[model samples]
Target: MFWSAEADTSAVLLAQMPVVLPAAANLYSALREPAAREDEDGTHFLFEAGGQTIRIARLAGVPPEIPLAAFVPLDADGFDRMEGIGRLLRALQGRTIPDDHRLTPQQKRRHRHMLQATDGRMNGATYRDIAGVIFGVDRVASEHWKTSALRDATTALVKDGLAMIAGGYRMLLRHRRRS
Candidate 1:
């Protein structure tokens, strides 16, 4: 379900559209590229294309009618791209889109650190505790630890970890073809 921040009508319109579960799944799978970021609610997706950022979210419950002429306000190019996506979904029907991709060595390392940070956070560890575990206690307690590069890095790691679990995990699989 796509909506504008300023309007509730779009949400209402989306809710009324017939539920095409496979299309929704395929749409999400197609959208969840390496760059995509999902909101904490697990419904919204944010990504960039052609240097423009895009966001789309799913509606919760189905409504009665989909209003004709309801349009999602996007730039012309963006609108065209969205139309293309709709066409692709119509063409594929219920067929699934392949989304597997291999994690690079760098990604693997970052993912590991992210998992560690996430685990620590879930276990009630403070940022300092997590930083100590990953970056060394001495380093975390140093004068530079306050407003330091290490602190910033740790915060970024936690945020990335949360984003991954939120929706990025779907795109972490090894792809059949190499880029």
Candidate 2:
């Protein structure tokens, strides 16, 4: 689940972008299955278009019926915001949204393992048990449990997964940046 600020990376803020006025204002009218949620900051709309979920947020004062402008900030997340908006625009234009390249194959595998390990731990499974399930029971049995690399990997997965559950999952929406 995403918190308010973290969700900004995924949700398009219509109030921030320069208004496309006149004809463009009717663009939102064609969106289907819009689910609106009212919050202190604004009203958020979730639309399903082109088999993708499009999140749009309008500031508190903006009328719910009127589609507001969306702005991309000049910050670390500028590229991420632009990418998200690009996907939304493509979906709006009846084009296919490309796959997200943020997480590569290895990262995807590790994330999947992390969630699996976390779930196993939550269900009272031991690290050895988790490793067995992930790396195959036969492979896990071939190595000494106390000093095996697979054992350490299983532990790390559970640790990272717990961190994600503690709100670190928000980072998934961001692009990696090196200092």
Candidate 3:
């Protein structure tokens, strides 16, 4: 149902937005049943047919700032050789797709910690108090706690947790490419 003069642009836009064409959804449903790989960038949906390798990458971009569903072709030659490019394109147009916002286990854990820390702060706990609760009172009371590794680590964790809550958590969600 989607129409585009340019294939690459269409692919990128479809991947970036939550709009789903039945075609694209069906394509993803059919494709993701195979084993996928995870890396620093994102999850890669790969398969082979017609003697060519095809790869569809769901890239995780910085959250809040970027859309979570951005998908792209990893293999240019293979993509060009893909048998159903036209069908995929039509599927990417017109309709809306459900958002896949499930967070990873690590992200879920971090989110909980972040929420707890933020709640503590909102309830009148100081940075030192927060550190005490998180790193142990003995460590917080140490002479070097304020200027040492524990303090730095606590600060970093708080900042990262806050950022994730603010928006970064969106990146943790899997895009709507169902297996």
RMSD values for the candidates in order, in angstroms, are: 12.7, 2.9, 14.9
lDDT of 1 at 146: 73
Query: 1-179 in candidate 2: lDDT tens per residue?
Result: 22464455767766633454564545655655345677887867776666677666666776645664666778877777777788878887788898767689999999999999999999999999999999999999999999999999999999999999998887886666546
Evaluate residue 63 in candidate 3 and report its C-alpha lDDT on the 0 to 100 scale.
27
Candidate 2 colliding pairs: 14-69, 16-71, 17-70, 17-71
Better of 1 and 2 by TM-score: 2
Candidate 2: global Cα-lDDT?
Answer: 0.76
Candidate 3: worst-modelled 10 consecutive residues by lDDT: 1-10
Reference-based lDDT, each prediction = 0.52, 0.76, 0.49
Question: Which stretch of 10 consecutive residues in model 2 shows the poorest summed lDDT?
Answer: 16-25
Model 1 steric clash pairs: 1-58, 101-173, 101-174, 101-175, 102-174, 102-175
lDDT of 3 by residue, 1-179 (tens): 22121332222322444545333433343343267555555545543443333345555452223333434446532333232344343344423333223456775676676776777777887767877887789977875755778777666677777786687654442222233
Top lDDT prediction, candidate number: 2
Ranking by TM-score: 2, 1, 3
Give the Å shift of residue 17 in candidate 1: 38
User: Which sequence of candidate numbers ranks them by lDDT, best first?
Assistant: 2, 1, 3
Scored by lDDT, model 1 comes in at: 0.52
lDDT of 1 by residue, 1-179 (tens): 33342322112112233344333333333444343223433244344444333344433342213321223556323443344344334333544433212456777888999999988988899888898999899877884667788878888899989998997664442122323
